[model samples]
Target: MPRGTDHRPRYEQVAAELREQILTGDLAPGAQLPSTAQLMARFDAANATIQRALKSLKDEGFLNSRVGKGVYVRNQPPLVIDTGAYLPPDGSFSYELIDVETLSPPADVAAALGLADGEEAVRRRRILLHDGQPLELSASYYPADIAANTALSKPGKIKGGAPKVLAGLGLPQRAFVDRVSARPPTREEVEMLDLPVRTPVIRQLRVVLSDDDRPVEASVLVKGAHLYELQFRRLVSDPEANDV
Candidate 1:
């Protein structure tokens, strides 16, 4: 609204203003946003501008619009997943490794771990909990040769944490490559996780690699949206001063 200022896209400006209000908690979750006509009058902007701004917010998952109902703030909070950390540092969460079996690797997983076609791999399933709350459902696979030395070849050998069991077998914990995505849960996952129909779950596929850069394990973790917060931190470097 300042005079003599360069102009940007009107919709972007409107969206930014609304985004600030939402983020500042001025507009709480599930709170209804101003109607398009109301916002137009308030901002003295065209209907197209307001609609575009709202559409952008909706696409970003900050707002939801229902037919015949006005736009409202999204009920679900933003997901914060931590991809940088490993599980069970000095005994954190309770992990139950249910079963392990030698099985043919699935096409997608086989490609991810760079396994040979029709190769036998150890498939281990686990159910992990955080303070009695079901936190994650996981399935992990390791190359047959790598797992053959360990007890994973036997069914139900690793009935707790795979990392702990592997460490006991002289294979220490290693680095991991993680891929993350969000989707609605399948019927089985929904029931297993005890999630509601509308709740969205996050899936992380992790490939655990040994010190030699050979992938030794592949894990798929399905986590509920509400139970965890992901955080990332970075150090800022000042160009003016070379000092840390």
Candidate 2:
């Protein structure tokens, strides 16, 4: 055991330490870990405890074991979500339409769509899949008036995605704002995403604005916390002034 005051269980502490190493590339992808006996000696723990730690990491997709060789770090790369664009999923991804209906949305979503109290909105619920794995659970809301009689109110994918549909209706998407947070996955989320137990979820509430600053769409996007990372890039407004 390394000298420290982390009060977690010994196995959990060992798992956390090894997880950090894997994430930081200290344990490179495909690199085999030390032998079980070496790990037990290094952590000053019993062989069973070391095995338990390895099992935890393996369950989390950080490590893999060979039948006769050894445990090695898995070559898994976290998905990078670019925050500045509304790019549609490429060929490797697909959308599974869960449902479409008109209903009064949550308060925050209502506010985002500028809906009046009790005013209904059309919601398109979908599961975004990347190479057949669930990547995100998304629910996009549209003002009832704007969505009525359109594909957005129906129960199938919109050709070219919602942006194109909105554009065809003369409400071309101009910009979007996202508010992101992370918390424990809801029961439904855990089931839908097939997330590991206790894995948190990252939620992004995105509001899309059209011409004349009209709020045309709002979506609630949720992804497993461990599977993706958000990327944001902004230009320095005063680069000259920032010179050190």
lDDT of each: 0.75, 0.88
What local lDDT score does residue 115 receive in model 1, on the 0 to 100 scale?
A: 80
Off by over 4 Å in 2: 1-7, 85-90, 240-244
Tens digits of per-residue lDDT, candidate 2, 108-219, equal 9999999999899999999988889887999999999999999889887788888888999999999888999999998999999988766789999999999889999999
Error of 1 at 184 (Å): 1.4
What are the models' TM-scores? 0.58, 0.88
Clashing residue pairs found in predicted model 2: 1-43
Pairs of residues clashing in candidate 1: 80-230, 97-159, 97-160
Error of 1 at 213 (Å): 1.5
Estimate the TM-score for candidate 2. Answer: 0.88
